[model samples]
Target: MTTLMTVLGIAVFAVGLLISIAWHELGHLSTAKLFGIRVPQYMVGFGPTVFSRKKGDTEYGVKAIPMGGYIRMIGMFPPGDDGRITARASSPFRSMIEDARSAAFEELQPGDEERLFYTRKPWKRVIVMFAGPFMNLVLAVLLFLGVLMGFGIRAQTTTVGSVSDCVISQSAASAGKTACGKGDPASPAKKAGLRAGDRITGFDGRPVTDWDTLQNDIRRTTGPATITVDRRGGDVTLNADLIRNQVAKSDGHGGYVDGQYVSAGFLGFTPAAGIVKQGFGDSVGQMGSMVHATVGSLVNLPERIPALWRSAFDGAPRQPDSPMGVVGAARVGGEVFSLDIPPEQRIATMLMLVAGFNLSLFLFNMLPLLPLDGGHIAGALWEAVKRNLARVFRRPDPGPFDVAKMMPVAYVVAGIFLSFTVLVLIADVVNPVKIT
Candidate 1:
């Protein structure tokens, strides 16, 4: 049954991935057609076509490889400096440029001269190229908001799960010693008669519905504070003298790690965790936090390659913060499905994973490098700048920037990306990350 669940989860994730790829391509296809640019093919994968249908001027298809997708726009690059598509050259670099230009004009039909992608205004071209990543961004935002506001997130609530016997740091609690040593005083919660199942209503006369807010209120207070709890259908009030104690602080990446201790008012009660629906503002804030973390992870990717190599072949344990490829993510989805939790929780977690994947796609595609949507957008912007400068100086128009000239650079970037992807894939298979 567990194996079946894992397979089902992976299959579901694969479907979502294909849908995301199709959605991404649809953005480009729609925008290109809207601008009268002829898109010959709208493919949802990279390999041989598995299914296809022709409609209007576009051939929509799904390919065998489900990794990525693209829409082939006619005349993606402008003609060469001589105002005509050039033949292959002896120089490898020049041949690369010419080959790209030739492919762009391969499916050129009658009246396609005006329908070429490069013939469109720079702003329109930008929109056409930017639409793909923007679609991903939109999908990510919707999924994130849906999961956060609709399904809610697992978080600590104000209800007390357990009360400590005595005051002790978290580190000490983790060392197999539950009881406080001699000379240690009873915990404030225990001394104040706080017990499990008591739902805290207020701290220091400040009403707090959530554990985080209540925790912050408690941390900031140093003296005696009035604690109101809903106990057995009645409000019970108690006064607890808070003391400055060492406590663990948030490490800011979702999980708490060993870090500098801070002096805060300690309340020695563990809050019960529950699913809590967040407000729109809170959801947006969480999305922003995810975006920040994702960007940081991408920026640190290069620094992690060495660790990935070690884990792939040297039997090193995978770091908790190690980067995950699509395979790792799918495996995680499978694990999530096979967890001993409620079905709703599993669905929510899976949706969150897909949302995070889409967000990563949006961010990754927006990088201003060749073979990416951002690269074409950058080229269009450069062309616009050059033309505007020429107009201001009463000089001859520079025309559209020849993005084909960057074919060599694009090839290099693609090669590096492929190498990194393969490395991550190997690491994922060898030292897969465990949720626990």
Candidate 2:
């Protein structure tokens, strides 16, 4: 029964993934059709078709892989000189091809010849290219709004839920002592004079509303010295010295694992953080704050990427509880589905996650590479500006150039995507992102 339920949960997540991919592709398809561009094939997934159907002019199908979807526009690639599109358009054995490329331009039935995508206005073409990311953005915003208006939001309070079993060593603990030796605090925590039971209310004037805020802020601390606490509701301030936390965790083997740690100047004080409910009108505020937090994370990616890469490539294996991936997401989803959370809260949580997923999709897709919505948007903008500039100088309007001309960019995009996939797979195998 447990196995079956787990399988079912994965299926649900796969469905959601399909919906996200389809919604992104649908944005392009609908907008293209609105402008009368020909869409020869519309497909979900990649690789050979497991299922398919032929519509009026388009062949609709599902591919073997469940990662994403695409709509193949006629003459989309290779300045038309690549000859693949033209040859395919001219191929005699088109129908012999599998469904993955089966409905491509060359394979379209005779009646479907009139609506080639290139015939559309440049503006429409541009819109078609951008619609996917646009849809992703819309999805994200609604997700935020839904959680806010429907179930309300929660804000973090300074009160600790429970201190973690793992103390941040060197965090105001006594030197040469593993456990705050003689109460003479070791390094950073001791130098800063931080103590337990002190509630940190501010850091460098940034209000520490809750544990989440505090931790996230701490990661952002660079070349900093200062700590403020609201000990028993009384304000206490001290200069914080930078210190590192090196935790020696168990390898689960007979031997201990050497844990190289990351940290800032800790005042030795720690508190468990949690989400407490916010008021009705404040749900909107909750959305805004959460977004702010996420955006901050994104901005910090350049630095964080190094840590992630080191963790991945280092000789030591990564711990499973480190971060998240599909496995973790599925676990969370399954737990929610089985939870006793009130309907509103449950729904809100689910929406928030989905929204985050969609938002991440949007950000990732906008990376300005081929095969992604961002890549096309980037290409279209380049072409539009170049052509329009030439036109203003009285040069004859050039005919549509083949996007296939951008083949190099396309390959680079493919490589990046492949790397990301590999990273995710590695993370899944090692960390598993389990909710529990």
Candidate with top lDDT is 1
Tell how far residue 423 is off in model 2, in angstroms.
Answer: 2.5
Shift in Å, residue 198, candidate 2: 21
Give the Å error, residue 432, model 2: 2.3
Q: Which portions of model 2 miss their true places by more than 4 Å?
A: 1-8, 78-105, 108-114, 157-328, 335-347, 434-436
TM value for model 1: 0.95
Deviation of model 2 at 321, angstroms:
10
- Count of backbone collisions within predicted model 1: 0
Per residue, candidate 1 scores C-alpha lDDT tens digits across 63-182 of 999999999998998889887796658999999999999999987888988899989999999999999999999999999999999999998889999998788886666666687789
Error of 1 at 125 (Å): 1.1
